[model samples]
Target: MDNETTTTYRKIIHIDMDAFYASVEQRDNPELRGKPLVVGGPPEGRGGVVATASYEARKFGIRSAMPSKKALQLCPHALFVRPRFAVYKEVSQKIREIFSRYTDLIEPLSLDEAYLDVTDDKLNVGSAIEIAKQIKQAIKDELQLTASAGVSVNKFVAKIASDINKPDGLKFIGPSAIEAFMEQLPVEKFHGVGKVTADKMKKMGLHTGADLKKLTQDELTGRFGKVGKFYYQIVRGVDERAVQPHRETKSMGAEDTFAYDLTTVEEMNDELDKIAQAVYNRLLKYNLKGRTITLKIKYHDFRQITRNQSFPFPVGDLETIGNTAKQLLLASGIDDKRIRLLGISLSNFGEAAVKVKGDEVSEQLKLF
Candidate 1:
């Protein structure tokens, strides 16, 4: 299609809350205001991983998925609270209602973020940027919260633009500006370019989109396979993927890479208990249960194995997740092994809703 025809066909907006879980906690509890706050599990003893770190905590080098033990070391005075996914889900639904005022094509990425297509808005508003401003204001006025919005003609540019400014920021990358915006963006900042891929690109003198654009699709695919093909199109601002509102959540899981390895079974079980609790909370939040419980173990040498047991009936309770994982660990024989990571997940949503099936292992991505 022609460029003008393409521009009018899609106009996507990505709305991301500022440290969502932590922000909600701070908003509800005034005592947490202006202090470093982490919402996940307790930060004491064997501890847990951070689900979300407040901007204040982030200043101290604390981040989501980091060990709660390490978060305490970075900011000992930081406040730690277990996540209340139920409350966060409530807030998510409220924000979504606000989004419905502008568009029905809304795809939620998490409880904290969503992608909205406002190309043909319900309100008949022609300006995507204005619609974004209105949505952000509605969130602030109605929910007493702030969010960042990125407006562009497609999902990729809009997702990246939303992060340009954060914690109450809005950026619009129009059709003309997309080229310059992508060219200067750091390779690491590209959505799918993980650290491993970025390191390889840097070693090959490709640090920015401009540097990446020098390679042909065949050359890129030769270097990075499937992901390389993605890079070739993304660098040219050619992401045509539609805003899929009903993206299936194939699996729900929580994993942590620790500061130290567990040399004994006791230590490993403690970590597993924390991870199971996290997984259980997420299950409740999504209102999902699965028949499969997978226990993931990574050793100090980076070797990993997953052992999952399926049940006739789906389970999402805390006890089942924790106890089953511990049992699997025991059967696997963990004697004298140095364990560096532990995670638990529920998969095979098993008729929860909408028939979504998928599995994913996520890497830490920076939020603006």
Candidate 2:
């Protein structure tokens, strides 16, 4: 098939649950409805982050990944609650069932968001926009929750359109409108362009898609590395990536940036205990075991390094993960270095595992 014909006939939709964790909390509890809600660790703790915030809390500048303390400072009255991943996962399964009724081609980015290719839908819904509407309505009717959807020719545009009108919204960006739509989008809004990259782009006077389009492909690649090629095509509303329903989980890991650098071995080990437990929980959730354990460390000056050990047999126990990570840390010679960030990851699972897309820029860039 020709490129235009190939692009024109494709139907992709991106569905994102609005403030998923916070919304689920509000849905289950009448008191949290309409009130600003923060789902994550409580503000009373020293090192807790916000997992998600209700729309009402978002109005006060609270966002996912912000410190719970900062979220509280933004809106002192906002209620904080811990995340119930098991409950959220159960709800996510029901959401996936809803999507399966329309199309089997589903790419779940997380528990709360996914992409569906309805080019050949099971229900014979010829219109992508109509399918998106039906899916949104079904989620509302069946689950007592709201979802926003974006329908377009490809994944990139569809994902961005999904966010234009959030919390129960549907937007369809047709093939003809894709060019103009992409050109006007802010650089920061582009996927894979994080705060650091966006700041760099703005300082270079590249503030919007139009500004980015002005640069040659070589210029972009030279300035931004390999991902610059992605920027070049995406700025013109071109994304050819197919939605892979069975994207392999090459690795699973978690990392944390500290509020203050750790200057002692005891302090660093304490942080590793927390991080390793998190990794263990995730491994258990996916029923995955890995043969490799990697420890990543970032110094106070931002110099980062990784140390990993591979075993003949796969392991997932919390004790093994924690001890291995701590051993890796001490073996790295941290006599005089102050550390600001630490991470633990497991990889080389003997078989395929489901991948949960992470918020890290490095991980997001790998999708392209």
Candidate 3:
């Protein structure tokens, strides 16, 4: 093919490892291979929610982040293991090293997921699908782990296609095949559209991707605000968002719904402390020193609200975390109400060492 003709097609790949942490444990200990293994905390106490589960556990409707008691109720024979972040991170680095051989345009969504743009690769790969197959096989053979990959002309299609088939699955979507591929795609599957958006779309008579396309841009924009433009383009299978690396940091946080609404200051404080630790851990890992601390609270009636305060200096200390959270709690002045959820987030991150997107403007936007 002519060079100009070749330049018309962009090659993008999204690779996600299959049940990463749980799979790693199973791979290292063959005895755990066929069992329904869950990785997280113990299956007894309040903090025991599964972080990852083997595919066998999934068949029993046991899923990640589900309560350990609930998972055991679903799969009584399931095996539970503690989370090993160090091991998973090591495997992730190894996987990224493998991708560097094909393209340096890599944007990691998480330790187990990433987007790769190979349009200007030095490897001179002729076929995107062939490259995806090779990457998957390499992961399996070298790491003794399974991975699913999607190859497409852009990031959006590649991400969605990657999940079409799971655990050693590979799918491709070319420019000519975009229309057929999107015809039956659910609104819930659209990029950036979550369960809340899906419900809103359903109420607006939009069910499938085709149905979403019928709405005027203004209509979708009115419904979705700023992200409507993305929805419109996705419905038409036209996402211009490049898979460039080094996108900046915008916001980070953690939230949790309680099994029962908490009515006391002590109970709320306990939950807030846990959330703060989670936020701080992530901040330390990413080397993010944030100046703002936010607290989110939800009442028994589902009336949710948030409060935030900016500090003079970037903070990552537990004392600052607790105090900022307490200040927010006092500011909300909802002590009489039964709190159903608590969340803590550190934002206003300063300069970071890594970039996730190539465009400086996009990096400033801090979009994922």
lDDT of 2 by residue, 1-368 (tens): 66564435589999999999898999999999999999976777354678889999999999988988899899999998877867887898899999999888898888889999999999997999999999999999998999999999999999999999997999999989998888899999998899999999999999999999999999999999999999999988789999878766778887876767799999999989988887887788777889999999989787999999999989999999999999999999999899888999999986645554321111210000
Q: What's the TM-score of each model vs. the native?
A: 0.78, 0.82, 0.78
lDDT, residue 153, model 2: 91
In Å, residue 134's CA in model 3 sits off its true spot by: 1.8
State which candidate, 1 or 3, has the greater lDDT: 1
lDDT at 303, model 3: 88
Give the least accurate 10-residue stretch of model 3, judged by summed lDDT.
359-368
Cα deviation at 136, candidate 1, in Å, is: 0.5
Off by over 4 Å in 1: 1-7, 252-293, 297-304, 309-330, 334-353, 356-368
Give lDDT tens digits, candidate 1, residues 1-368. Answer: 66564325587999999999999999999999999999876765556778889999999999888878899999989999887766887898898899889987888777778899999999999989999999999999999999999999889999999998998999988888888888999999999888998999999999999999999999999999988888999988988888776667678888876656789888888888888887887677567888899998888787999999999988889999999999999988888899878888888776863333111122121110
Better of 1 and 2 by lDDT: 2
lDDT of 1 at 224: 94
What value of lDDT does candidate 2 attain over all alpha carbons? Answer: 0.87
* Residue-wise C-alpha lDDT for candidate 3, range 110-227, written one tens digit per residue: 8888999888876888777888888998998999998999889889999999999998899988898897778689888876778998998899898998887888889888988978
Task: Estimate the TM-score for candidate 1.
Answer: 0.78
Q: What is the C-alpha lDDT of each candidate?
A: 0.84, 0.87, 0.80
Which runs in model 3 stand beyond 4 Å of their true positions?
A: 1-7, 252-287, 295-307, 316-344, 350-368
TM-score of structure candidate 3: 0.78
